[model samples]
Target chain A: MSTRRIHAWPVRLTHWLNAFGMFCMISSGWGIYNASPLFAFHFPTWSTLGGWLGGSIAWHLAVMWLLVINALAYLLYGALSRHFARDLLPLSVSAVRRDLFAALRLKLQHRLGHYNAVQRLSYWLVLALGVLVVLSGLAIWKPVQLHGLASLFGGFDIARYVHFFAMAGIAAFIVLHLTLVLLVPSTLPPMITGGRRETSHE
Target chain B: MSERKKAPPKLEPAQQTQVVNLQRRLLLRSGLSLGALAMLGGCNLQDGDQVDKLLWSMSRWNDRVQAWLFSGQRLAQTYTATQITDPFPFNAFYAEYNVPEIDLDGYRLEVSGLVERKQPWTLQALRQLPQRSDITRLICIEGWSAIGQWGGVPLRTFLERIGADTTAKYVGFKCADRYYSYLDMPTALHPQTLLALDFGQVALPPDYGYPLRVRVPTKLGFKNPKHIVELFVSNQNPGGYWEDQGYNGFSGI
Candidate 1:
């Protein structure tokens, strides 16, 4: 068995920072939503991040900057380092399909030093989704000033729903991500310590 | 690097136009759906007290960004009469039943601060000014929106007539309901901003600001101070009731 550097400092930093920021954003967002709820039931106050509507707005606006800056940094670093190409791209369709079936059958291999086709695809998709969430959020937040953006989403109303549903999608992704992480417990340590344990092929 | 490709032959104007439109439509549709789907994943599973401090700090930063983005010349979306929300929802810090009652016979709008005229204008005088009507959306920060037909003097007209120092930083309002708010000078001068007198065609009901309210379509509903009895133009930041309580002062959407 051998250990190797897997996650970079920037990757781990952004991953955890985003996790923290999104936590505040989603909880407070629920509080703000409760004021004029679209769904039948409201998020329980204790579970929600912000204490009240006004407080929630404050929290959302504040943490939004953190998420934006962190995401931007992650993207810029990934691009400059060619991390996307080396780690997440060149995904073969056949391999992806095989991995999908294997994962579904609970027969997928847990590689310590590498990502499977499904993992790479999900990570890339989530990255893309994060950017969309921010843009749609901006469209809803400043529809008049960002009229062109709002119109692109059909209208301001559609933009709001897009933002809402996008958040929900991200929430769903988190659930699957957590389950996968637990199934492969070693993945969590590398994210925190930027090191991985693996058996030498030779 | 790969060699650059040669340019394609130009198409006829009609054909070119059709191709461009098709591309635009495709791009718009894909962009919308992709944007909607991509933002659909992620979760935060931890609870901590320090999160509040971080959020509040970020919220203040967002306020600055929103303030920078606001342009007085731009207009909020206006809808047709048929599109107006039937019975626009009444929202406030207090219950709908607790709407303040004012003595119409004694109502006076007091003007103060950096203005040539500081006279208190009567409701009758305000009505005589050139009036305009608009059906504009009122977007609440709480995530709902409604359109209402509002009729009154344009805030710009009223401010100019009152000889308000247009260069002043802020236009502050003190309302009859004890609620108070203020607007940036540029927003105050927005062509569509109204010192609204009526809800539909009739005088505004007490629940809807009664004798007078500032109907700022460019701002969130709370920034539209209701039952305004006092107006002041000043350079100092006149913090609003909700603003003081942590809501953004320039709560534009």
Candidate 2:
């Protein structure tokens, strides 16, 4: 077994920053949602981020810049390093199917040098959804000025739904991600320390 | 392992072109629209201790963008009287109980700046202006919205009557409750923007800006300053209460 750097410092930093920002945003977003609730049920105030509508908006807007900047930095790093192409790309359908089955059977393998197909796919999907969430958020935030963007999503109301659903999707992904991390405890340390000890399969 | 050995499927030329076109359109739209703001400073995000300044500058840039997008002719969507929220929520920086109670007998709206007439018009005189009414939604920055029927003189007409320099860059308001805000000249002259004296077909209530409030349906609720006691047209930027605190001045949505 050898200890090697599995995640870069930038990656780790951005990941935690994004996690904190998203947590603040989603919880505060719920508080905002409570003000003019679209759903019948209300999110418990204790579980929400801000104490009131004004507070929620303040938190949401502040965290928004955090999320945007960190996400963009992560993206730029990934692109400049060719990380996405070398590691996450070429997501063949067959690999996805096999990886999904392995995941379901609790037989998924962990590798040091690269992500498994399921990890790659999920990461990519989450990234894409994150971009969508940001776009839809902008549309809702400036509906009239960003009228074209709003119209692309159908309309302002539709953009709101898109933003809501996208956030929900990201929240769901976080649940699954955390569960996977817990199940494979060894996976968690590398994200924090940026290195992992792995045994050579050969 | 055997399944992974197979090559990925290929898309037909038509399908490939469609995908490329879609991507291009999305890129172009965001680039052209958001580029104005994103390109303003071009400052590195990692600039330590300068992030707040950058963000504030971006907010101001966004204000300019929204102002540019605003058109005086485009009216805020109107609703029927039945659509009005029964209890249009009372919202302010302070609690509802703290809503200022002005002395009606001495109430006067002092007009100033870039205008030929700097006369202080009393509430009675303001009421004499041709009263127009509309049922429009007031959107708050807090993601809530409510429809209300508001009646008052059109701000454009009043601005014109007062000889306000319509060419001025900004229309600023000072409220008796220590609240102040301003709008871009275009939004100030918007057909739907009103010096609202009545709410729900009655004299404006205290909780809502009593005596006078600027009802700008095109902008977020915060941009619509209530309990307005003074107005001025200016070429210089008159910072708003929230706007100074990082909220966008041109908060149109």
Q: Pick the candidate with the highest DockQ.
A: 1
In model 1 chain A, the worst 10-residue window by lDDT is: A47-56
Superposed model 2: Cα runs more than 4 Å off = A1-24, A27-59, A62-86, A89-97, A148-161, A182-202, B1-74, B80-82, B93-106, B127-132, B167-169, B176-178, B200-207, B235-248
Q: Please, what are the lDDT tens digits per residue for candidate 2 over residues A61-102?
A: 667888999999999999998778876987988999999999
lDDT of 2 at B189: 81
- For model 1, how does the per-residue alpha-carbon lDDT over B127-240 read when each residue is reduced to its tens digit? 999998999988887788888989999999999999999999999999987788999898899988999999987898888888999998878888998889999999999877
Q: Compared with the true structure, what per-residue lDDT tens digits does model 2 show for residues B78-172?
A: 77888899888999989988999899899999999999999999989999998889998787876667889989999999999999899889999
- Expressed between 0 and 1, the share of native interface contacts present in candidate 2 is 0.24
In the range A1-202, model 1's lDDT, one tens digit per residue, is: 2544688888899999999888878877887878877779888876565456676676678778889999999999999987788778889889899999998999998887688999898887787778778999889888888889999888777887788888888888899899988888988988999885455741
- Cα miss at A31, model 2 (Å)? 5.8
Best by lDDT: 1
